[model samples]
Target: MNSAGTWATVTSGISFSQFENVLGVLDVPAMSKNTFLKKEVEVEKVWLKHIDNALVEAGIEERRLAIEKGDVDDGMPFITVIVDGGWSKRSYGHNYTATSGMAVIIAERTGQLLFLGVRNKYCCICDRATKIGMEAKPHLCYKNWDENKPSTAMEQDINVEGFKMSEKMHGVRYKYFVGDGDSSVYAKLVQNVSYGRTIQKLECANHCIKNYTGHLHKLAADKTFPPDSRKLLKQSIPRLTAAARGAIRHCADEGETVDDSISDLKNWPYHVFGEHAQCRNYFCQKVESNENLKIITNAKLLDEITALVSRLEQKAPRLIKNKTSNAAEFYMSLLAKYNCGKRINLGQRGSFQRRCYVAGSERSCLGTKPI
Candidate 1:
């Protein structure tokens, strides 16, 4: 067993019934038994041994981060765990489909579980399960007097809030986190990670598959070169990303129209027009055809381009002043849009390094942020 030290967390998925309140609390800090002291389902009854294995499995590398779960914080040992009652089971076409709700636990040291609640993945999680007004604050959330369920977006917000509260109690740091398959839940948590020009180790996580952008697929089409040559090109993906972003920006700035004739065709092919190929070519044709002649990696040119954007935003002429907002917002949108709740997921050369995918649609999400 890993030694109990700094902070540790355990998580599990359970049925709604298992989330019933016993000590006036639902799941964490203490699991409230049902009226008849009902026994738990085999799946919900995960043992400490299993939690033990999971803790190590949850570790960053070969060893665990915390000596024990209790060392989280003195007053509030913020912990979050999930029961991945996925929404995939639900059918949107049919009349309706039932789904087991996701459950979570937030606890403190001495094994006192603080918060326990179940939330449905597809339907409304903001409903009050009981008819009672909020009796007390249930772990940074309002617990209605008679409800067995949460009253806000607490199901997802709690994890975000727990980290904040724990940080407030102690100092904010990535002690440890426990989560499951709910992509939405994970995305909310990842937004808290640090990302900028300098920070090397960004705190993030995701399970979403990275999908390649149109421009990358086309770039990789040349298979004539042997494996070694292609490997070299792949390694220099930073060049690809930088080149594409620069080309797109220049073209857009000049109002150079790139025809998207294929994007709206009646039956778009699965691998249509190559990832970002049309856009990249359009950029090259417009303002700077010489931009990518010698560029080999997206990495080498990053500092220069970033500095250019910064200078343009700070000292560009008045007529072109507002254009900086477009530039800033475009990348900001990309950062948020490309991420699909996967932990530390990244893409390269306009395609997913591993998988290319986006979660639920957010109309406002536009382009990637500087990571």
Candidate 2:
């Protein structure tokens, strides 16, 4: 029965009723829903204990690697980590009404989950009790977020909590953080978490390039630009994306120093537009003929592209590191498999957090010995 309940939550994201129906279809005897719920409580306890142990082991390994890599500062180990946040419901980048949100921190060195947290804005028992105008029964409530706070605020809050507890939980500090372009989380960390040193923010390479692509697409669809300019901008999207990605790869592979990589990245826009005077030979052979180059002839379009390049240049230092939050993103994707597209309200009874524990344990234990 406990195994069945575990499967229902970790693999199927099905309620006990759904599991019972499946059992009935198979002509197999199933435990009562009340009994199943009791077993699920046990399952949650076991998974939580396992996840705690796994995180501790991962932290130890991360610290050892950081020291070996000379990432320590003044005898204190500092590791670079990737972080990302996800919501129970899809916001589509506009709507922010998800009742639950989660964020995770993964060590860049070991690709292991260091910390994870979830926030909930609703609790089934509390809401039910309120509806009846009576005192709620004592229960493990999952509601931590205030009703007045926006759902979007959950990400920053969870991230701040994770950062503040890093040293205490893992015996190491997250000196460098690789996250998406969101500045609010980083700003909060700078203000709240006191590691007795500065925490540097590293921009995710993929997000940076993605944002650049989005900007070009937005410009292409704008009516203010001349039709010719818009057409040129549309045509330049693929080329610009390719150029940016190639530049990042080349810089990462061949550049001797971070400064060299930044210089190379800053010069890529000019090279793509047939202004190769500053181009490196290794990057572009500088063919004598400009006939093959799709040079932007529109002055306005050229200015816009130049401005975009300048904006990207300002982020060159962060991009040169080439660090990414892909691991954290992958963990979120795995989490979606368990949560099953927000179709069920798992947050009401602390079930959402237990599911998260399963996901984190699966990720942290992947290709590793079982705890």
Candidate 3:
């Protein structure tokens, strides 16, 4: 029975009905829905316990690394962490109607999950009772979010909760926060989470570059630009993004000071637009190349691209840290696999949370023995 439940939820995000169908095709008797639900409850308990233990161990490792690296304040270890959030439904960068959302904090040193939180805006028992015009029977309610709050706000709330509980859940303080370009989460942490000191925000290099790429693509698609200008902009996006990424890498690895790094990044646009006067020796070798080889020639288009590069320059200091939320992102991808591509509404019950726990456990225990 336990194996059946694990296969249904952990191995594949299939409903009991689908599981029964598979069993029928195999000429095997299927467990009743009630039995499957009971078994799933047991599996949830086990996975939750495993996640708790993994978090505790991860925290211990983080503290040890902090101490070893001399990142201590007044005898308290301080560590850096990467945070990111994911929604159960696909938003495609616009829609935010997901009924459930999840966020995670991963220690930078150990690359293990330290904490995770989920916010669900649905309850199957209550929904069923309301549909039938009857009172909700006593059952495990999964809804925990306020209906009045927008779904997009769930990530900030979950992140704040994780930051606030850091000290109580783990003995160390999150001195540095590495996340995407969203300032709301960091702002909330600064305003709400009391860590006895300020939390420094570090930008994920990939996200910063991705945002720059997105702006260039947006400009290419805009109707304001002429057809030839748009074609040129579209063709230049790959080189532009590559140059941005290379600037970041050079600044992070080669530059001596923050100002130096920022200056190098700021000069990248000029070098790419055929002005190599400010180009560093390592960044550009063909200073003698003709200006006609420049990809961006339109004055207005040059101004727009320069404006975009300036935005990236403002974030150069953060990008120099070279920190990323990739571990958290990998865990979210694992969650999606277990959640089965948003085809099923797992959040309607405890199934969504249970599946999340399974993913957390898998991520936390990666490269180790199975829990």
Candidate 4:
């Protein structure tokens, strides 16, 4: 194998089973184990033979699906229905244990990934959360340090027999490439990226503000835009501010530092230069940096929130709590009620007017009354 191939193998995750040898044996009721085995075998057979075969025939040598468009789903698209056995760590706590796995489905649509992870059994009989085909398809997998072979998470993941739905769309045109069909991880990544995308969606406040400011600077130079377009911007300015505020508030709910978050728009290289400038993708170029990424990730979740609030200020001049009032009473309560070291009282008793005096100001001692 080539150098890159060798590296890939070294870093690649272990096989799906990753569980100990089942000795090709089990003790579940004949009905349960029998049914499970048949379904498992059929899934693997189809995945390896159908999906794998089609992708390879079209143009694929490996299954480490990456973050891009894969060949279209064949009418028989590839599907890997995975499941897990009780053994997570060692397989069998004793000398040996049975190997178990789950099977899920996969397919290509509009160049993005689509996955369906199903669960078969629930840890507790009363826990409906783990039941098979439990709607919403939310991932219920988890890890059990005490288990042997199949990790706790994997065990839940493999219960159901997931499969591709629209085998009909074998030939069509669409957009967006789903990253390495890691549906679970991909879904989260897509969400995170989408959130990032929203933040970077448009230069509403700063961009427009800067543009307006620049326009003022160039008032004497070639002024071509009609007054109506200028009016459109002025009107849009408020919406952008609202959007910025929403972004900050939403990020706050996630316990994230909305300010430090980068703009997803930055990723759309075209934003900086090209016909795609107005396109959401192009306009959504995100600003990425270590400090910023941390905020986006809500790693420490420190000053980022304040920064977001500051951005909110820039976006919506009216939203700024320049004066103390009860308008944001509910939001203010969060500061006092939060586990974090957020200050609840403004040192004065009245209502929240502006953003808590910007954290650390010598004037904070001035009491609840306006300084």
Q: Report lDDT per candidate.
A: 0.28, 0.79, 0.80, 0.27
My TM-score estimates for the predictions, one after another, are 0.24, 0.90, 0.92, 0.19
Worst 10 residues of 1 by lDDT: 1-10
Query: Model 3: residues >4 Å from true position, as ranges?
Result: 2-5, 130-134, 291-295, 367-371
TM-score of 4: 0.19
Pitting candidate 1 against candidate 2, the one with the higher lDDT is 2
lDDT value, residue 236 of candidate 4: 36
* Model 1 ranges with Cα > 4 A deviation: 1-43, 48-118, 121-155, 164-172, 175-371
Candidate 2, after superposition: displacement of residue 178 in Å? 0.7
Please report the candidate that would top lDDT against the real structure. 3
Q: Which whole-number lDDT from 0 to 100 does residue 224 have in model 1?
A: 46
Instruction: List CA RMSD, all candidates.
Output: 19.2, 2.9, 2.6, 26.1
lDDT of 1 by residue, 1-371 (tens): 11110001111122223333322363344334231122222212233234334322332221122334443444423232221222112334352332222222222111112122233322112333223454423322211222333323434554555434333333323333333223455565557533111111111111110011223333444564344434544554455444434433443466443332212111111012123333334333333233232242232332332333332223222212112222222222332333332222121111111111111111112212222
137-162: candidate 3 lDDT, tens digit per residue: 99878799986688888889988888
Comparing 2 and 3 on lDDT, the stronger one: 3
What local lDDT score does residue 7 receive in model 2, on the 0 to 100 scale? 60
lDDT of 4 by residue, 1-371 (tens): 22222222112221112111232255322223333333433333333343333433222211223223352343222222111122211334353322222222212211111221222222222234445645433432222122343333442343211211222222221112211112353233224332212111112222333333343234213235444433333443444344443433444445544233334112211222122333343224443333322322233222322343343344332222111112122222322222122212211111111111111011122222321
Model 2 CA deviation exceeding 4 Å by range: 15-21, 27-34, 255-259, 289-295, 367-371
